[model samples]
Structure formats: structure tokens, C-alpha cells
Target: MTDSLARMARRWWLALWLAALPALATAWMPVGDPAWPDPQLALVYVERTLKRSDDGLILSAHLALFRSSVYRLTVIDPGADAETPRPTLPESFQQAGSVAGVNGGFFHPDGQPLGLVIAQGRRINRFETTRLLSGVLYSDARGIHLQRRAHFQDQPGIDALVQSGPYLVEHGRAVRGLSTGDPSQRTFVATDWHGHWILGATRTRLTLADLAAALSTPGALTPWPVERAINLDGGSSSGFFFDRGPDVEPVVMRPWKPVRNLIGLTPR
Candidate 1:
């Protein structure tokens, strides 16, 4: 070809590469896991006091069910704890290794329960499932189908019911350390079952009433119709602890740590 033609082709190729550079960068950038360290933690504590004591809200405290002295508080979106590393592991969890559950659920370096498992993505080569969020609750085998719409922006409430935390009941006992995916990643999942819906988040927290109020407005996070919802782990560990006893407000595990992802529940 002519010298000028060759030069023109080279320029075109360079231009094409430059144009694709931004997209490539975005693709390489990690999703779910925040650029900064934001870890979250959740725990199930028993409080005999009618009103639980609080030391300020850690994570985002939203009262779910306050009646019967059994209160459910949804905590979401908090900062990370320095001691923990990527893909945090829990000591209480049963380490089945790769063949067991998804990524290890969010946990303290010493192994603390954060949240339940919901959905996770599989690796391209090893096919390993990576946990996207720390504080979300996931469904059991029968509820596995709830993850069908796992990674979508618009989550169905029913599907979320299968993915949120409330203590995993297996063989009539609560099994601790259940993870669907990983600690290094996070995702937004939601579900709509009847009028009740469930919304999962990482870096987002809204009280049950606040979420209900948000749904009433014109513009909302999830476009689908939602009756009620609660906040889950939002930051790193993205976990919560509900305490209902003598004082007021429920006690949360990591009140300081920032959570990125969480799973919320609504009453029937």
C-alpha cells in the first residue's frame, strides 16, 4: 500500500484503541467490593430487656418487627474493619472448602457470623462462586430457585426472602456460617412476592418505614412495587445485631464498620 494509506490505517487503529480504553478500564475495575475498605458485621444476640440499649447506630439501624419483644433490626452499608482481609472468613462456619458453599460469608478474622447467603457468580475457569455481599441472607436448597434473578437491578421480594438473614434453620436447628458467595465482591438484588418485597443493598440503608415511604414517591431505587423493606449489611461485612431488652434500639455487631451490602425483610 502507499505510505499515506498505511499511515492513515495506523491512525485509525490507534483511534479505535483509544476509544475502547475507557470501556476496558471500567470492565477491569472491580464491582461490589468498594475501591476503599468498607467492612460490615452482623450478629444474633438475645436481650431480655424490654428496651435494648444502644451506643449510637452502627451500620444503619432500622426496626423491622418490634412487637413481642422480638425485634428485627436491619443494618446496612458500613465502613470496613482494618483487621479483616479480602474474602473474609468466619470461624463459626464449617469449612467445606471449595465444594461446599459459595464464597465464605462476611466474617471477622476470628470467625463471626455476619449475614446469610443469597446469590453469587461463578468464576469463568474454576467455576467458583464468589460471595457478592457480606450481610445478605440466602435461601436453602429448596429456595435456590430464588437466586434465578440474582444479579439483576430489579429484585423480586419473594426471591429476596430466600436470600436474607434470620438464622438458617436446617434440620430444625439454626446453622451458623452460611455463605452463598464471597467477601471481596458485592451486588444489589431484590424480589417482589405478592405485595411484600425484599431489597438487598451494599452501601445503602433505609428503615422499614423509610423504605415504605420511599416506595410511595415517584422515583425509587427499585422500580417495582414494594410494600415494606429493611436494611441489611451495606459496607464491608454488612451485618447487624438486633437487641430488644431494657433500654431502646437493638444492639448491632459492628456499629462503626461500614457495610456495603445487606438483605431486608418485610412482615406478612
Candidate 2:
């Protein structure tokens, strides 16, 4: 009888440990209704307008904690069908949802000269919010860190925000850099510049004060000067990508995994 009790206790403990494994192994993502194309990926839907005066497209991406460690890239396709189908990463990059060091993550298209230079190598994940903020600050080759500005009142009910580095305007103005803000609500903004400003958090969202500061300052850094930009889903649902040109095919950087929401940037 004593031996049987001990075995039962051991089994109970083992079951408890197994139940807690998921919570301990990964981060948390509280997305609404993520439009996941695959059971192992995550996705979000975003739609924004771009004014005719706006310049190039703005793409972004993020990872889903609970469903996957995969990243989903969002961009404006002027030629794609209205029904956008989710595509997987190249065979060389696709993983089994738990493997690491997969190829074909967030990257630029092949043979495309850098018109808008994107500096990679920085470590930005879903759990670490500051890393992404810091990535934007030192995105240039010079590696200049930015300051976090105070909150802006452009959007009300914002709880917190984070300012990137500084902006390099076309007129040589040192305007505030990019910012990620939160209005304590799920709000999505579509800009005329093909930029999408989404307000929601699967992990940590930015505030209004933070965005105002970055937008106000210009010429704050070196290399790939910030002309104009906007915020995205910072948590597990924030990501972007582009196909380089009209004729060029969609080179999957961060694949369109499952997401809670997305800020789709369509060309004007």
C-alpha cells in the first residue's frame, strides 16, 4: 500500500510539472483573434490608408509567443489579389515550430540595391520591448543611441510610449524620431505615407508621450536617416516586409505567421 501511494504521488507531481511546462518554456501573448494560416504560426490583420503625397511603403513584423516564435511581415502590395494568402518561408529557412537558427528570417530582397537602407544584426524579439526601441535608435551604421522623450497628447488615454533615436528630415531638420505609443485601447491608424500606426499589445505597448518626443526631434542620428515613420504592434504581433519592386517576387523575410492583428499598408 505504501509503495502504491508513493507511485501515485510521483505521477501526480509529474503531471503537474508537465502542465506547467508551457508557461515556463515560453513568453505570454494575449492576442484577440489572430488570423493564423497555420496551426503553428501566428498572425494579425492591419489595414491603413496612404495619401498620394506619401513616399515609399512601410512594413513591419512581430513574433507570437504562445503559438510560435515565428515572425510575420506586413507590407503593401499594389499588385496582389485582394485575398492575400499566407506563404511559408523558403525550404531552407522553414523550421518545425520549435527549432532555432532557421534561415530566411527578416531580410531584404536579393539583388536589390539599398535605396532605403535597413540595418540588421540587432536582437529584437517579442519578450524584450526595449531591444526593439533600441534597435530603431541605433539603426544606423554609426550606432547612436536615442533618448526616450516625454508623452504626446495627440492621442488620449495613452498609458505609456517609447521614442526611437532622432529624425533626419529632408529639409535638414532634427525632428523627433519614431515612437511607439499606447492609448489603452486597440486603435489602428493608417497614414498617407503608407505607414501604419497600430495601438495594441500582446506583451508591452508604447504610450502617446513617447511617440510625440520622437516625432518632434529630427536629425538625431547617422546613416539611413529617418525621413518619416510610424509605430507597430510591439508585442508578438509586430512585423513588416517588402518585395523590393513590382516585378520582383515576394522574398519572405519574416513569414506571415499567425497574428492577432495587422496593419496592412497598401500603396496609394
Candidate 3:
């Protein structure tokens, strides 16, 4: 083959490989654990293999680690009116100027956010109690905080908040009594020991107990030890989105249905 023709073929192959790299990297499979000595805006994608008593499952999760000191966490609402079009995860991410995010609390059929929702220091909804909805995630100038609704205090200087439930982890341990056998897609928000935020979701179906175990188990898919975690809306409503940067297209696991609210992480 001529030198120029060979060079052109090489360039074409390189272009194809470059285009396919992100899709391949984001595919569901286990990945090596990453270490972050200093907190910053970073995302690690993992397809974790879980050890269940009945059978194993692959849990696709994106672990986004970011310092609360360097980023702002906020809740986004698409409004309560029925006429307003609900935004998908990617739309909410772009609209909120978020680097990473996940679907927020559960909502009613007409798209009204259930439980409490406070955005940018403004109260959007009041606290409500339900069987499964038990946790609240809020942020203040001090940083992000998670607690059960019964324990959460209405504090000053609060910036954003969302209430969702079935607390997955508390005080660094997995909360007990989660459904261990029923498998379904799941989404969760958590904080590591150092208070760095983590948003994750299973790409495939898995029981809630399995997910809690995976997040709380050290040396698991979760890169850091999870100090606290809570289950968000899952099943058809589960969604996750992360913006790698300007050069790469964002990783978006879209919801099967439109969502009413989202929790977004914006770089500070």
C-alpha cells in the first residue's frame, strides 16, 4: 500500500476508536477501585458484581466524588402544574448547570413532588411522612447533610433540600430491613466518610438489600466508605447523568418516564 493511503487508513481507524471509547468505558462491568487523596470534582463509573445469597448480579453505578466546599448541591423542580413539561435527567443536568446528578424524591402521578422540597433557600413543599419515605437530604453553608425525617431539623442558611426515603445507610452502616429478594432498578444518594457526595444507580435490576450492602461494604464498588445513604425513586423513574467535561459527551442513563424533580451538583 502507498504511504499516504496507509496513513489515511490509520487515521480513520483512530477516529473510530476514539468515538467508541466513551460508550465502551460507560458499559456495565466491574472496574478497578480509584483513590482520591484530595477531594475534587471527579466521577468513576463502575459495573459492580454483587454477592447475593441466591444469585449474583451486575450493578452499574457511577460514583461521583466532589467536595462540598468546592461545589453546590441543589434541588430542581419542574413546577407542579400539569401543563409544564417534565424534564429528563440530562435536561435537568443542563438546566441546573450540573456536572453530575440523579433523580430526586418520589412524586405523585400528576408530577407533584412528594414530601419536602426546598430550592435555593426557598421552600417549595412542606415535610410529609409516608411508609417508605423517611429521609431528607439538605444542604447549608456548612455542606450536605442527610437524616431521617423524624430527626431532621429545620435549620437556617439552608440552600437546597429534597426528601426521599427508605434510608439505606446511617452513621456508616447499612440500615437493616431492606427488601432482600425483590429485584428492580435502584437509585441512591450518599456521602462518604469525608462528606464528599456520591450519586449512583443500578443499570440492571437488583434487590434493594443488595444495593445497600454494596454501597456500605468497603472495597466494593463505592470507592469510599459511605457514611450515609438514602434511596431515591427507582424502577421506571430511576435516572443518572454525569458530565465528564467539554471534550466528552455526558453519560446519561435516562428514565423511562418524565420526572418532576432532580438533585443537581454544580461546580463552585
Candidate 4:
């Protein structure tokens, strides 16, 4: 009887310890849905480590969720070589007074934007009907949106917009034809369509198809399920920034090279 009791006790303790391991592992990284943002705050930063279902590879990701009603998304353009000294993402975020930002749009080798870019309610470039330029991230009187190039409408009074992509997610499913090879760093934007949007970047390198599959999976991003997502200018242009506040260190992932435009948030 004594031996049996001891064995039972050992088993119980072992189960308890095993149960605690996952919680202990994700200390800075939350396993479940993180705390929703305070109502008064416009944006909330989230950190998560997601394990891919097939290979069980871990993807460490950073995310920022902002309420659309309280914040207005903008394109912070450095302009057409108008200034001698130009700021990269970190410095641009500092100058614009934005809470969070990510690198935006694709550009040509000569530093010209590849597709439509609107800033401060003016068009910087016109739309291009290329096979790769398949989506648009823009804001208008109806609010922020990620629309397929097929469905997008050219509206007046559009203040902020960037056109770039090969859609990562459409109608909540990963687009089927994304390239599976050439893994690289990535940045993207997703929306729940219930007044919230997210900016995210992968610390781990992944193919576009893998990223699209991971994002379309549930529990990849917290507090809301994604309805739509569009890839931003990734690869070496994959930069991200979020200002936590004065007391906490801000989250910043610098791009490998200089980028032409940035998508950022401003308190309305």
C-alpha cells in the first residue's frame, strides 16, 4: 500500500509539472488570447509564438491591434527627393507621432514607387494593373479597407493609400497560388472587420504560402479572427515599429534596406 501511494504521488506531481511547462515556456509570449486593449487606448501591441501545424516549426511574431474609430491610418511618404536627410522607419515613426508603423509599398530599382501611393489626400502615383499588384490598402469615408484590385473602386477624398500585393488571404482563406519557395522575412496587415485592424511581422523566415496558411489558421493572431489580410513590401523591406510608451522599450524591426513609403497610425 505504501509503495502504491508513493507511485501515485509521483505520477500526480509529474503530471502537474508537465502541465506547467507550456505556461512557463511562453513567459513573455502569451499562449492564449492576450488582454484586449484598454478602451481609451488606440492601439495594443501583442507578442506571440505560434507553432505551425504541419512541421511544428515555431514562428515568433509581433502584432499591433488598433481601433479604427479612435485611430486614422496614414501613408507617411518621405517624398520625391525633396529633402537631403531622409529618415528610415524608426525615425519616420518618431517624426510622424504615430503609435505604430510598418514599411509600405513596392518600389523600382531607381526608387520610384511601383503602384498607386496617396498621401495627405493627394495621389503620388497612379494604379498599375500588374499581376503582382493585386490588392490595395486604403482608407476613405467608409473607413480602412483591404480590397482585391478587382473589387476596388477609385473614390475621391481618399487621404491615405498604398497599392501592393499578391493577396495573402482572401475571404479568410489563404490564397491558393502563393509561391512556396524562397523563404524570407515578411510584414502584413489583417482585419477582423469589426472595427479593429492588425499590423504584424514574422521574426522567423517563411515562404509567402506558408505565411498565408499560418495567418489563415485560428489562434495565429489573438482577440479577433482575420477576415482579410494583404502582404506588404516584405523581403528586405520588412520593417516594423511600435511605440509602447515612455516607460517601456518600443518594438522595432528595421528593414534591411531603405523603403520609399510607410503605413502608420495617428490618433484622430
Sorting all predicted structures by TM-score, with the top scorer first, yields 4, 3, 1, 2
Residue-by-residue lDDT tens digits, candidate 3, 88-186: 678778977887888888988977788878976678767888877788888887777888888888977888898888988888887899998878888
Q: Compose the digit string of candidate 4's lDDT tens values, residues 30-73.
A: 34664555634568887777665445566777888888888878
Summed backbone clashes in each candidate are 68, 44, 0, 0
Candidate 4 accuracy as lDDT: 0.81
TM-score of 3: 0.80
Q: What C-alpha lDDT do the candidate models reach, one value each?
A: 0.29, 0.27, 0.76, 0.81
Runs of candidate 4 exceeding 4 Å displacement: 1-41, 80-83
Residue 186 in model 4: lDDT: 88
lDDT by residue for model 1 over 123-231, one digit each (tens)?
1111112343312333322241222224423333323222232222222222344443332212222233332222232224423323322333221333333332322
TM-score of 1: 0.25
- What order do you get sorting by lDDT, best first? 4, 3, 1, 2
Which parts of model 3 have CA positions greater than 4 angstroms off?
Answer: 1-54, 86-88
Of the two candidates 3 and 4, the one with more favorable TM-score, higher being better, is: 4
Q: List the residue pairs that clash in candidate 4.
A: none
Give the C-alpha lDDT of model 2: 0.27
TM-score list, all predictions: 0.25, 0.22, 0.80, 0.83
